[model samples]
Target: MARPRKPLLSRDRIVTTALALIDEEGLAALSTRRLAAELGVSGPSLYNHFATKEAILDAAADTVVGRVDLSMFRDGRDWRGALLAWGRSYRAALTEHPRLVPYLAVGPGLRPAGLRMADAVFGGMVEAGWPPAQATRIGALMRYFVTGSALGSFAAGFVGDAAAYDPADYPHLGQAHLLARHREQVDEGAFETGLRALVDGLALQYAELGAGKDDAQGGAKGAAAE
Candidate 1:
């Protein structure tokens, strides 16, 4: 007798398998037929789970971003430590699925899990005393830096990849790359150092804002004394 058929499929398994296929063969290698074949099912079977190819890709993107640990700083952890942890986790997840980086860069999907993860990170910053506006700006900057760096590093070796530009044409760019290389374990070191500096810069801004608030209060009291 033939072997028994497996149980029913779910969205998570489909997303996980899609991610794995992309990791093993790159994003260009993915397609509904390819995925179904790899999953031991017929092409039409995938349609029952995902309505279109874009939908599947979107789910894959969600799976990648969902791996980030945004709640690391929720328990009243130091603000700097929290931001650093967020940055590191973001970098690692994106690096693991470099081909998915483009989709991730477009921002998280409309899925509930995606929204919750973002709120958790931003909420942590607010709880640590960062105003919503400032927190939002700082978060965007950190993401740009981390994602941009990972994109460069992941494509560094592949020629004809438009993302890889020649440093010789840009002197300062060349110099910065040289300095980065000089640093110990440059890849990891650069991520941490850049994150700390970015966070520190934000802290300075917050301090100045606090001082301005104090000054205004003191001026108001002085005028009332007269």
Candidate 2:
């Protein structure tokens, strides 16, 4: 048989496969041997593209972060609206593969996509009149909020044992047993509530930044006229 023109594997294929493995069975399920079986190639071939398992994992994790929509950060859009939209998009990406939250929470590291996502958020806030320091903080704040939300289901925690919430010892949790059934509703509600609170609180600080600037300008003008 003649040799094929195209190779069977590529960097993107490796990354996509790694991501799927992590999504389905979690971070621990990913191994050179298993990934090779899934990819239908020799284990040594995996090393041809990625130097190590952690490097491949980082690439896969970065692929998830890259899925976030940054269009709202473009010119002419206000920060508040942009934040809400971005928050929804970000949450969507993270929630899809909850197991990868730990990898992402460790920071961007050397992942270009992750760094770009962070840059978009920080740059957009700075462009929207937020002080540089506060803009940095907003990036960190949203990251913490988003990653924490994706770590696990608050409702699922009470599952598997409805009777655990007894009337005498846990009277307040009488209805808590039903929480598992309403997992989606409760978790989504909590994420939105927290996201809104963060943006709303920042909006106040945003207004103050402007007010302080105006006050300083007025004082300077008055002094010049003296």
Candidate 3:
């Protein structure tokens, strides 16, 4: 029988299969041998496409990041609005693959998709009148917030048992036990509240900087005229 007309292995194919394996069985289940088996190739063939398991994992994480919509940062768009949309999309992407968040959080971001994401976010903020230093910090802050949110399960972790909270030992715990009933609402509400606060705080800082710049220019004009 003929081996095949076309190439049977490629980096894209390897990354896609690796991501599927992780999504279905989690990171622990992934191995070059398993991936090779899934791809109908020998274990040594995987080494041709990926140097190590860490490299494959990095590619898988980048695949997830690539799903995020960064079109909001396109030319002629409002940076603040774009940022809010990006944040929502980022959170949504991570929420779908919560198990992958840890790898994404620690993985080297040299991959194309990850690098593109960082560039768009930082560049968009700078275009919107933010200092480069501030943009970099804000980009990191957004990543931290989105990743942290993905890690939490407020409703599932909340203490639902009324008996768990003793009134004798906890006088102010009367309504605390009921929090579990509203876990989804509470967690979502908290995220929205914090997101809005972060955006608004940045907007305020931008306005202050603009005002200070105008004041300095006016003072300089007056000095020049005198």
Highest-lDDT candidate: 2
User: Model 1 scores what on Cα lDDT?
Assistant: 0.77
Using TM-score as the measure, which candidate wins?
2
Where does the lowest 10-residue lDDT sum fall in candidate 3?
Answer: 151-160
TM-score, structure 2 vs. true? 0.94
In the range 1-226, model 1's lDDT, one tens digit per residue, is: 8765965577888888899988887888889989888888888888898998889998888777778887786666777888888888888888888777776776766865567767877888787778899777776787788778676463233344333445556544433434433443656677777788888987898789789889999999999998
Q: What is the C-alpha RMSD of each candidate to the true structure, in Å?
A: 4.9, 1.5, 2.7
Clashing pairs in 1: none
TM-score of each: 0.79, 0.94, 0.85
Q: Give the per-residue lDDT of model 3 (tens digit) for 1-226.
A: 9888878998999988887787788889889899999999999989987899989988888888999999999856787788788988998888778778888886336889989999999989898888899999999999988888887566667587888878999888777777878987887787788888888998888899899999999999999999
Error of 1 at 50 (Å): 1.7
Where does model 3 exceed 4 Å of error? Answer: 2-13, 24-26, 37-41, 170-183
Tens-digit lDDT track of model 2 for 1-226:
9888988999899988888888899999999999999999999999999999999988888889899999999856899999999999998999999999999999999899899898999999999999899999999999999999999999888855768877899878888888889999999999999999999999998989999999999999999999
Question: Please, what is the whole-model Cα lDDT of each candidate in the order they appear?
Answer: 0.77, 0.92, 0.86
What candidate 1 gets wrong by more than 4 Å, as runs, is 1-5, 152-184
Give the CA lDDT, 0 to 100, for residue 89 in model 2. Answer: 95
